[model samples]
Target: MSRPDILLYTANTMNGWKPLIFLHEAEIDYELVPVDLGRKEQKAPAYLKLNPNGRIPTIVDRGNGDFAVFESGAILWYLAEKYDRFLSHDPKERSETLQWLMLQMGGIGPMMGQAMFFQRIAKPNGDEVPYAINRYVAESRRLLEVLDTRLAGRDWLVGDAMSIADIATYPWARSYFWATVSVDGLPHLQRWFDRLDAMPRVQAALQLPEPRPSVFGEGDITAAAQENAARFKDQ
Candidate 1:
């Protein structure tokens, strides 16, 4: 195979999967360089030069003057614009697509991440703070309801076809179970999710760099979470 022009530095987390889905859907040639979050590889000086925030899902576009882009949402926007795929050029549709994409970046991603941090990570470490857990989980559920409302009677979040908005949000929304957020009464969101879940590209993207571990699976996730938490605490 030809050398990939895009180098994706990522983990198996929800945010990390956004670019993977987009790249797969767009059929772009990219290399996956898995960042070992547990090992604090993201915090190392070399990686920090690429992503000052020391986060996963940073992409170095070697084909584009060796440009590096951080933040998952930004990466999606950059790739979509560069490849001229999964994004609309029409004024209204493009704005709508970006609005929903921002919702994922500002709403679903943060709320769900906090929910997961508190529900799965904090609670297991004997730091079971009920207020934080309930606060984030409820907000995450409410965000899902917002998406459900947007998806009502519509197949995609924006325009008639799936765009970066859908790709960015799906990874987080699908992890509601891990975050302890429910989709109990959200039919539209559920339907949209099932549709994306059934897509060949989405399924293919989730497996790159290996499958992510389930919260319900066998492993010492608590210790893992604690290690990660300690890293962030020092940061």
Candidate 2:
């Protein structure tokens, strides 16, 4: 069987960008089929056939001409399994790395999402939006502490080098500027992020598309996220 001809259908979503960031990091060759979420392209019947949720970041594995993968986390896991790199073969290390990957998928994604929701989308009527900010910011800080502990001595998520764990996190953790106002407290994680940023592969991935104007101050994604969420909820 030949290596599959692949089309990664994705928008510029954090989730969508996960696989692209990984593919670029791992130096995998594949075609990018930009799926415009703004045009309602993801909800199109043809696209829905690939992902029932009609989400971007779906991949068609043309080698079989039948297999397609959805879910950003699943896609990165699949790519690592297929490419046989960016992940460890050892059982313990592999499991550890996978744990971090899931942590980012489950922990960071939702917490930060709520941050975007209440802070930017809902048009909060207060100076602080204390409830929303405290909730997300606290959880985000907790998760970062977990990551920092894991990196207490190691340089990477896995035992030896950068792995799928890092790749999966590339889109979100790398957006630290958006997730939090300061990582100075997370010295280890901050260092880890800096190290990942310096890699040639990661550097190449960054060149693909700049992310959200750098997460410097608090963002205003709440309005957009709320609108999207309301639309999805209504549907």
Judged by lDDT, which candidate is best? Answer: 1
Q: Write the per-residue lDDT of candidate 1 for residues 95-213, one digit (tens) a residue.
A: 99999999999999999999888766676656789999889999999999999999998999999999999999999998887787889999999999889979998888887677755
TM-score of each predicted structure versus truth:
0.91, 0.82
Cα displacement (Å) at residue 199, model 1: 0.9
Q: By TM-score, who's the top model here?
A: 1
Backbone Cα, N, C clashes tallied per candidate: 0, 6
lDDT of each: 0.87, 0.71
In the range 92-196, model 2's lDDT, one tens digit per residue, is 888888888898888877776666555543533334577778788777767767778888788987777888777777566656555553566778887898787
Residue 126 of model 1, lDDT score: 62
